[model samples]
Target: MAAPTPRALRRGEISFKLDERTAHSSLDLFKKDTSVIYRIVGIDPTKVPQNIERFTDWAVVLGDTAVSSGRHYWEVTVKRSHQFRIGVADLDISREGCIGVDNHSWVFAYAHRMWSAMLANKTTPISNIGHPERVGVLLDYDSKKLSLVDVSKLELIHSIPAEFQGPVVPAFALWDGELLTHSGLDVPKKLSGN
Candidate 1:
């Protein structure tokens, strides 16, 4: 019998930061880098700004704002680089492991021309999608649905139902000199008194 041919895997779209508004948007996430290398330039009426970074390794950062309920959406720009992950995770998930390795987190990964959704250490392949210049993320906490979108063409890439145990925060990971710029952050209104 003849050997079977390898199944071709579709490569996800590579995106760029077309939205210049981020330069003035309010950033809700930052980390202790060699310096304050990351910054937010602008934000929308919702007060969510784009997260921008030139690309670094072994770095994980969480949004200062936490969302326990309601629907949320955000965009990430990866002007360059093919290895990075973006998603939401529980406030207490271990940063040591991969982003989507456990039930504590749900992340979308794109590399080597394939897009996959990971949760609870399970990975699902999403096909027929090319790397776009931008990717949008939608989260419906009440319904436990998380989706990834091709922002440049306004197309749906994939959606997964997630059962989260507690509050979740937007999470980002990058390494080996890869840069990712993300936009759209849901900022909660602060009360007058603590």
Candidate 2:
């Protein structure tokens, strides 16, 4: 059997950008806030005001826009990062801990060359796929389904079904390296089934 080719199924795209206010002190936002790089030196706290929305202990950032309804899709290109988490989470998710360890978030994580799908402290190991350069996220708000795709290979990495409490935003966590986000993308036919 061969992998399916990626094709556009619908025209649902979103204006996704990282919310700098929510970024951790150790992370620096660049590329018009579409990309973030982790800095060991960290930013000077004196320059950046303390905000409750900021992630205090984790290198995490949330999307500026929240999705409450309809279908949406976006992509994240992993650049020089071996450990990272890409997914969606409610706005109220704990800013102190890692994502996917709380009920408000669902993530596809890659760390130490391992892949897993996580939710509420539960980790489901995913095997048989190689490292992906770009990961695509598909959120069907009406259906409450979140999917993670290995865009480089055009493979479905994982999917989660949940009863979202309210609006959710794209969330990312990076311990090392950098990430670039691409938004306003049409939901792929292979994943959207339209």
Candidate 3:
């Protein structure tokens, strides 16, 4: 029998600043070296500027932002297969400081489609949390699944299945002592994962 292949390490990355718009510049998640930025389309850390080309890690372009170890806020876009990810981070670029501040710029990239091109890669592509205490849980388009994980620990907290509608992306909210979401479909289902 053939030996099983080991799970590949999912590399995430992002360029970030402490407060580009609301406050001064800083990367709180900074540790010793640059951290990988992941993807999360719709969630907290809202009102970010649009139309900026997603950060390129494999790009050969000059002057691209370098990965640093520190705390920083960013707009994360998950790009494992489609390469459509964006976000910010405060990296430590040092590679020596292992412990990081991680105000939680470590973005999450999930999809409703289980067979999404991104999933083909090794990374879990977690969703970004909305606040320091809140989380960023999104629906995968391919797999039609929902997962909630801690942005700091990168632990899978919750997960559920959901399908894709059309142009409208699924938006989640907590109400009536339950977690419900607008499925971006005509008849939205009241989803509550146990």
TM-score of every model versus the real structure: 0.63, 0.89, 0.23
**lDDT by residue for model 1 over 10-126, one digit each (tens)?**
222212222222112222233321111223232242454323321112245554445567666667666454666778877666635557888888999877768899888788998
Which RMSD values do the candidates have, in order?
Answer: 16.6, 8.4, 18.4
lDDT (Cα, 0-100) at 5 in candidate 1 = 21
- What tens-digit string does per-residue lDDT give for candidate 2 at 40-90? 888986677687788988899988877878888899988889999998888
Model 2 gets an lDDT of 0.83
Model 3 has an lDDT value of 0.25
Best of the candidates, lDDT: 2
Write down the lDDT of every candidate, Cα atoms only. 0.56, 0.83, 0.25
- What's model 2's TM-score? 0.89
Answer with 2 or 3, whichever has the higher TM-score: 2
Model 1 vs. true fold: TM = 0.63
- List candidate 3 segments past 4 Å from native: 1-132, 170-194
The reply for model 2, stretches above 4 Å from the true place, is: 1-11
lDDT of 3 by residue, 21-123 (tens): 1110111112221122222322223443321222212210011232222111122222232222222222211111111112212223323432111221234
Residue pairs whose backbone atoms clash in candidate 2: none
